[model samples]
Target chain A: MTVQKVWSLFDRSQLYECYECSKCSGSCPVTLAGDFLGPRKILLKCLQHGSGRVIRDPLLWYCTTCQVCQDRCPQEINIPELLTGLRNKAAKIGNIPERVKFTVEKIAKTGRSVLGFKVERERKRYNLPPVVEISKEEISKILAETGFFKDLKIDH
Target chain B: MALRYAFFPGCVIPAKYPHFESATRAIAKVLDMELVDLPFSCCPPTSNMKLVHYDSWLALAARNLCVAEEQELDILTTCTGCVSTLKEANYIMRQKPNRRRKINRILEKAGRHYEGTIEVFHLLDVLYDHIGLEAIEEKCIYDLNMKVASHYGCHLFRPSYIMYPEFLSPSHSYVPTSIDEITEVLGGEPVKYMRRFLCCGYPLGANVDEDASYEILREKLYYIKAAHAELIAVACASCFEQFELGQVMIKKKYKETYKLPTLYISQLIGLAMGIDNETLGLKEHIHKIKKLLPRLQERTGRMRATL
Candidate 1:
């Protein structure tokens, strides 16, 4: 997606209204946690250097997408949504994280995000009913229909 | 009328933390809340699938909602992450016709369709709003006078517009007190503490950055400990896991022991309602509840003796 296309995904008014106020960064847990570039700086970078530059930054993955920054934004700028859109674009280009890839593959293979073998053992000890099963074929079909396998370049 | 819901036990509760599932089921039985089981998948985990592909996230979440919709039941989720993803997807599908059509096209391939016919709720919502605090209070056998620091995991009410419409008032989302009120009704003091509204950092720490995640956990723990809270109560399985496991990491890395026993809201309520620790899966927790368990037992024993 082009820089213009990226900005167009959001309400342009919300984007333009950003007065460089640092409240987003100030309220951001990821920013407060450590040496990561905060949301305010990220928005500024996207505006100046384009979404491509910001998407490639390792700091982009650090956002927990907790939505705190967006909630606290005076201009109501949806930082989490913007970050998600950027991440989607990054993922399409195969700039995704390994753990994220693993999670998606696991979900595609099994019907859940995490493996259920250990859960099966634990539930037996507790005498709980076995987990309800969903068709893995159906899950993969949905992913393939959504172009997930294509976008992430994961072989089904 | 007995309230019935399709229990949407998200991936984490069953796959990683079955104890949470056990406690929720036990509590549902006491409250007479019928939790119908369904073949459900991950809530697609907002931090993972949503970030990777918006359409896939919506499609997967929509599929789960479709499963519940076919049974003609609303979803009651134990994990806050599932609540957010499924609720947000429902909101988007309901409010936007074009988006719904686009997703339905994908769903058509799987022989499923989401008519947006159902609502999604966190277990806390059903407990506080539908079940009523007075009803819960009446069932309490042990009066827990312990100090509890309630963690209302972020996904429960953030992005206020889509979530809990009642929290649309600007200030309401800023200071959520449903869990606090529930704690009070259970005969426990919901202690005031700083950093109550912050995210638990599980999304970051679990997948992306462990160090940064620990930093966030340490800050939240510092405030809860300073408040002299005897135990931590969490509404989300991810946060419960983070608090329990984070403390172990903090002990090993920082050499500081906060030792606050983190309990799922259901487990905490179950204990006060005279449920046994073994049934609630208290033994599965990383932090030892040795001290708190004895105190609860003592209170119940005294109450029994008086009777």
Candidate 2:
């Protein structure tokens, strides 16, 4: 996707509403953790350099989507939502992190994020009722129809 | 009347923390809350799946909602993340007609439809609002006299417009008191601590940037420790895991031992309700909670002597 196409996915008015107040960055847990670029800088960078720069930045993945920045924003800018949109765009171009890819693959295959023999064994050991079987065919159908498999290039 | 809900255990609890499920089940039985099981997929956790493909996440979450709607029951989730994803999907499908239409088209492939009829609830909401504090207090067989630092996980109340529309005027999202109040009712003193509203960094720590995740965890642990909290109580499964396992990771990496035990709110409730530790899965925790057992037993002993 081109920078303009990526930029169009977000609300330009809301993006422009940011006044560089930096409260988002100041209150951001990831920013406070010391290496992240934070919301304020990310918004400024995306506006100036376009979504391409922000999408490719490794720091983009560092956001935990905690929404603290959005909650604290005086402008009510939804930074986490914006980051998610960008990540979706990035994912289309196959720019997702390896670990994220693995997780998505697992979900696609198992209809759940984490599943293994040990989990079943633990359930039995605890005397808990067996977990109901998810319809894997339905899950894959949904993923396929939504282009999740296409975007991530997972084998359906 | 007994409240019935389609129990959404989510992915994490059943796979990694069966104890949370067992504890919730035990408490539900005592409270007359009936949790019905259904074939459900992941809530399509917002941290990654939503980030990967928004529509796919919505479709998957909508499928779960559809299953509940078909059964004519609201969803009751043990995990805060599951509640966030499913509730947000329900909210969006209700607010945006076009998005719903598009997602329904996707769901057609899976033979499912989201009617937006059912609501999603976290276990804390049901216990506090539906079950009521007085009922819970009356049911307690033993006093939970320990000092607790209640960790209200972020997903419980963030994005206040969706999670808590009623409190939009003077948002309680930042300073949620339900867990604290619940703690108080159970006879545990909810200690005041800095960084109580902060994220547990499990989302970041579990998936990406382990170092940064540890940094956030360290910050949260420092404040809880400063308050001299006896244990940390959490409603979200992920937060429970983070507090329990994250401390061990912190100790290994930084050589600093906080040794704070973490308990799910359900387990804590079960303890006060006089449920056995084995049934509550207390021994399964990574952090040995043998210290807490003695403290609880001692309190029960004292109460018995007075009687």
Candidate 3:
């Protein structure tokens, strides 16, 4: 991947406190789940070559973002969020995962999340949280559901 | 007194998030208050900012504050994230003129200059401040009798700039203040459920395994369900969205667990105002608060008979 101008402009010092802390690696549920996520490797990449190359790593997609790292970080590096920052930068440069694209498409085609239910779960329980569907007519006006349903390919 | 203030229901509630809008409007009307829509755009600080482009996130939040400022009313929002984003941006702009100028410069190209004048508040702040407990009592038609838990999402109260004076702690002691005062006025019991003030896992919107996105709420709901509260109340939109959307996901993922009902402060107040579930946008929800329906019907029936 070509070097992006944004990489050079970012505040490098903002995320510089992790002293090879493996606590975040120890705590991350995603890391435990056999995903390629751990704070030690992440901190090494970020420090050695700058975040530019780290942003392009496909393995960065495996974060569950439980923030167990933030919970347990002795150095308080917010490792998961740093990874999220890298992923976000990558996304701007065209790096969304295929599964995410699928979910987005499903939401676009349907009004709700991909987990759109046939039975209203709100009705299943005695307690309901305040949620309502977006009306179709209203949705058409804003290209409203499109961004959420990035998986779908309607012209609008 | 003539009751009128600028109303700024963000992108979600008015269209897709109608339940919140309907209930809020109902409660606003019963208080004899008028909410003038601020016609602002999204604060756009979430998935789009911090993670994506921090500058655009701040700029989007700034654009929203500018629109609300033009109206010169304390911008009252249904969404806590919007309120926090706008308020934080307003504070940022006030404290750092140089950064504000750069953000304003981007806005100027788009024909907007953010002056950092408008104050942003979540719906709870307005209900507590403008319509005091006494006012709510006067307008309340239903004594709900619900034992409620409160969810204060991080963006609303965390940074202290946007939170009420008393609730500044993460393990919030003042969890029950907003819902308690309103519930007490409406003749309900206020109960402290476990983890009453934790994040609702809403911040994980932009990820895969979105069901697992609810990993945080399991601990939260376990504590809440343990308290045996009849219902939960919230002051934040993303939290409410998380609770309502994640209830079934939480139940299924966590293995046959039950959760109490959830309500935004507006919906609860709407019940107090004699607004029916249909008009309050309850039909759109798959999560059922059927427990409160009969109580609400009885109140409506009594009011109609008296008339």
Q: Candidate 1 on B79-139: residue-level lDDT in tens?
A: 8899999999999999989878988988998899889889999999899989999888777
Worst 10 residues of 2 chain A by lDDT: A1-10
Tens digit of per-residue lDDT, candidate 3, span B192-211: 86555545656544454565
Q: iRMS of candidate 1, one decimal? A: 2.3
Give the alpha carbon lDDT tens digit for every residue of B133-244 in model 2. Answer: 9988777777777899989899888888889888675533455788899989888899999889989898887667878888898999999999999899999988887888
Off by over 4 Å in 2: A1-9, B169-174, B297-307
Candidate 2 per-residue lDDT, tens place, A1-156, comes to: 112144444676788898888988898888878767888888898889878777877667887778988888888887877888888888877778889889888888888997767887888877899999988888888878877777777777
In model 2, which residue pairs have backbone atoms overlapping below 3 Å? none
Q: Score the docking of each candidate (DockQ).
A: 0.66, 0.65, 0.12
* Local distance difference test, each candidate: 0.84, 0.84, 0.61
Task: Assess the local accuracy of residue B216 in candidate 3 as a C-alpha lDDT between 0 and 100.
Answer: 59
Q: Which candidate should be chosen as best, given DockQ against the real structure?
A: 1
> Which RMSD values do the candidates have, in order?
2.7, 2.9, 7.3
User: How much is B291 displaced in model 1, in angstroms?
Assistant: 0.7
The order of the candidates by DockQ, greatest first, is 1, 2, 3
